[model samples]
Target: MRAAVLTGFGAPLSVRSVPEPRADGGEVVVEVLATCVLPYTGEVFGGRRDYPLEPPVVPGPGGVGRVVRVGPDATRLRVGDLVWCDPTVRSRDDALTPDIMLQGLSSRGEGGARLARHLPDGAFAEFMRVPTENVHPLPPEALDDPARWSCLVVYAIPYGGLLAAGLEAGETVLVSGSTGNLGSAAVAMALAMGAGRVIAPGRDRAALDLLADRFGRRVRPVELTGDEETDRDAMSAAARGPIDVVIDLLPPAAPSSVTRTAAMTVREFGRVVLMGGVGMLGGADLALPYPWLMRNSVTVRGRWSCPRTANVGLIRLIASGTLDLSPDRIRTFPLDAVNDAIAYAAAHGGPFDRTVLTPRAG
Candidate 1:
């Protein structure tokens, strides 16, 4: 089998021949059909070395594929079943005694140890080994249109954030970075969840127009020119009253300023959710003033997708057709072109709703 190997930090991933993985107790071997490139992959490779990963690692976090074999105790999944995996392989120490629910960002030593157990030789090759607990049987509906499942994989973070913020139907929700993958998913989900109005703040007019066409009157586009007063007025006018929830997906930038604006424009007890900023290559520092938050009784929460429960719900939504995930919104690339795919997604300023990598040509 051949896989993309990250030979060094800041080096291009190379496709090379490698041995195939084998199933072990409570584990299964999967033949890779497709996987998605996450924005954080570049950051992981660029020396954020905080997570448990070393060079020569296979760079992937989430993917969907078919089971080729199953080990003893892996009763939930059978050979030939299509599934989506919780690609973050954790160590017994990390999983058993988690100081933090750090998903895929384990330190180098920790990751190496975890990989030794969870990932067999050539796990990134054509056949990847995974514990049955890490695999979810793809519902029959999803198998018919695999691209739609991309929304489920990427939307977990925002879904968790919105749930944490205690979002309710008929409330106005504001989303920054509205044209990106997660942001677009947020917009669509907010609408599906019965949000009265979804305010999308960003500068991508063409993309916003497309979003508007898909989401109709549910999505309201706002320009982000750093014009504080203008933005405040626009938000206030669109929301009519204080906004119910403000979900910020932009890179670290003026959190204090944005929170203050949100506090004023949102209802007295409304919440603001911060779901972005991880893997930010470069961005300005955002200050969240404690005094202001305490005074206004505003809830400022940081959300990272950790628990797999939310992922299950996201998958159900996709399977039921409640979330719209059209193929035009997704960009597919072959595994050999992973680097090119990453570069294209980054440079294009994605409204790419979802991007997937496949073992074979699409």
Candidate 2:
């Protein structure tokens, strides 16, 4: 099996022939069909974000594949099962404070624990050994394009946050940075979850227009010109009323000023959920004017990825064709071209327009 191997921290990932993984107790060996390169993958490669994986390990978070073998005691799943593994695996030391796992960022054990009992390298290789716990059986509808499931984490992030915020059917929602993968998923998932309306506020008019074209009038596009007051007013105008909930998807890699503009778009007593990697890449702290927050009675909360139940719901919805993920154009690459895939995903593709790596291609 060949894999995109992490040579060292901040070093380029090298493609190398590695031994194929085998199923151990409570584990499953999956032949990787498709995987994705997200912005976080780039951040981790650049050493900007922290995860449990270290050098000499595979660097993928999720993938689509068929189980070739199942270990003893792993009765929950079976051989030949088509599955999509969750990005997060249970830590070897779950007894440790969960924060040490960086809120599910650490899938493998610390430092050089690759393809061992305690850890499973990510799905960047031809085959991956995964704990059955992290694996979810896929419906036939998703098997043809398991790559779509790789983007589930992005969709689940905002979905989890919205669920936490008690998003209602008739409430207006504002999705900041709506052109990016997480933001794009936020728009679609919000609508699928029954938001009364969704306002996409971003600096990219073309992307916003494309988003609106996909979802129709229910999605309103708001163009941001880097002017605080102007953008805030534009958000309000786009929504046609108070923004009941704001899902801030602007990463810390984006301009810090954009955060303030998003927070301001919410109406009095509205909820603001921050789910993206807001400060992971080093940026200005999110500025919250306490006086205004108190006066408006705005509530702010933080979130990481979504949990199991939400992902199950999302997968079932996708299976039902209720969400119609087929409309999105997914870009793909061979396993050896992982670097190029990462670059493209980081610079251009969003969840609606994503990039995937086909491990079997090479």
Candidate 3:
């Protein structure tokens, strides 16, 4: 099997032959079809992102694949089944508080690091082994265009945040940092899930305009002015009414003030879900006014990755035509061109531009 192996941090990936994976009692082997190349691939590869990924391993989080071998414990899954292999692997030993690791990418704490030791490889290769629970069946139609379905990998993160915020139909939602890839997807997902309006706030005027153009009246783009109070006011006004929910997806480079500004716009009793990297890179902690939160009866919570069930929810949205997956958004590359694909992804890191690697030769 051929895989692009990351020998070490700051080292170039070596694409060469590696031992083929086999399924065990509780795992399944998938023939990698299409996997997304994240925009931050170069950052992770160059040791800039500081992802706790010990190298000499294949480095792709997850992808769309076909089942080639199923373990004995599996009942429903069979060979040749189209599936989306989720990289968010949770330790089965503990259900309530499981140690999680994004296979072939990074881990959380020591517990997650330990989990990674057992499942070190990811979907960057011709064939990869994954836990049975992490493999979800996709519609048969997905076989026709696996790269289209692979877009689900990008959209699912925002779906989880929206779910955590308890977003409801007809409610006005504000997406902080809505110009970026994941944040832009949140805008689309909110619309798909029946949000009456989505307030997209960002400093990128062109990206904001693109969002408005794509979604029309349902989307209100607020070009941020970097002034915390002004940005917050603009986001609130763009909602046309009270902001029912606020989902913060700001990246690490964004200041805590930005998140604070977006979150404060939520209406009384509204929810705020933090699913970004704002504070992860070491900075001032997000300081919200205690009096405002208490008086407004605001509900604030932080969420990591999406719940396991989110994969199914995303599939349903895409299948129902509520969420579009136009082929124009995708650019495919062969497995051998993994490095080039990474560069292309970083350069094309826009709202819906997708860079996919097809490991299997047609």
Go through the candidates in order and give the C-alpha RMSD of each one to the true structure. 3.6, 3.3, 1.1
Q: Best TM-score goes to which candidate?
A: 3
Tens digits of per-residue lDDT for model 2, 1-362:
79888887788889999888788887788888888777667877777766555567777877788889998878678788888877654444444533212211254344223333245377788888877777888887666677776666566678888887789988999988788878998899889888989999877778888888999989998888889898888888888888899988887678667887888889899999988767766778888899989999999987666655676787786788766677777889898799999888887665487788889742
Candidate 3 lDDT by residue in tens digits, 1-362: 99999999888788999999999999999999999988888889898889999878898989999899999999999999999998899988898999999998889899999989899999889999999998999988888899878778788888999999888999999999899988998999999999999999888888898899889999999988889888887888888899999999888888999999999999999999999889778899999999999999999998887999999888998988888877238899998889899999989987888899999947
Give the better candidate number (1 or 2) by lDDT.
2
Arranged by lDDT, best first = 3, 2, 1
Model 3 misplaced regions, further than 4 Å: none
Q: Which ten residues in a row have the lowest lDDT in candidate 2?
A: 99-108
lDDT by residue (1-362, candidate 1, tens digit) is 78888787778878888777677787887787776666655666566534445556665665677889999887567788988876544455556643322223333354455464345232234567676777888887666655446445567767887888888989899886677767777888787667888887766788788778887787787766666677778877866666889887764333445534544556667798877763344443455557666777888777766466666777777777776566346677777777887676555446644566777433
Error of 3 at 295 (Å): 1.6
Better of 2 and 3 by TM-score: 3
CA lDDT, candidate 3, residue 150 = 77
189 in model 1: Cα distance from truth in Å?
Answer: 2.1
Q: What is the C-alpha lDDT of each candidate?
A: 0.67, 0.77, 0.90
Query: Where does model 2 exceed 4 Å of error?
Result: 48-52, 92-117
Cα-based TM-score, every candidate = 0.84, 0.88, 0.98
Looking at candidate 1, the ten consecutive residues that score lowest on lDDT are: 99-108
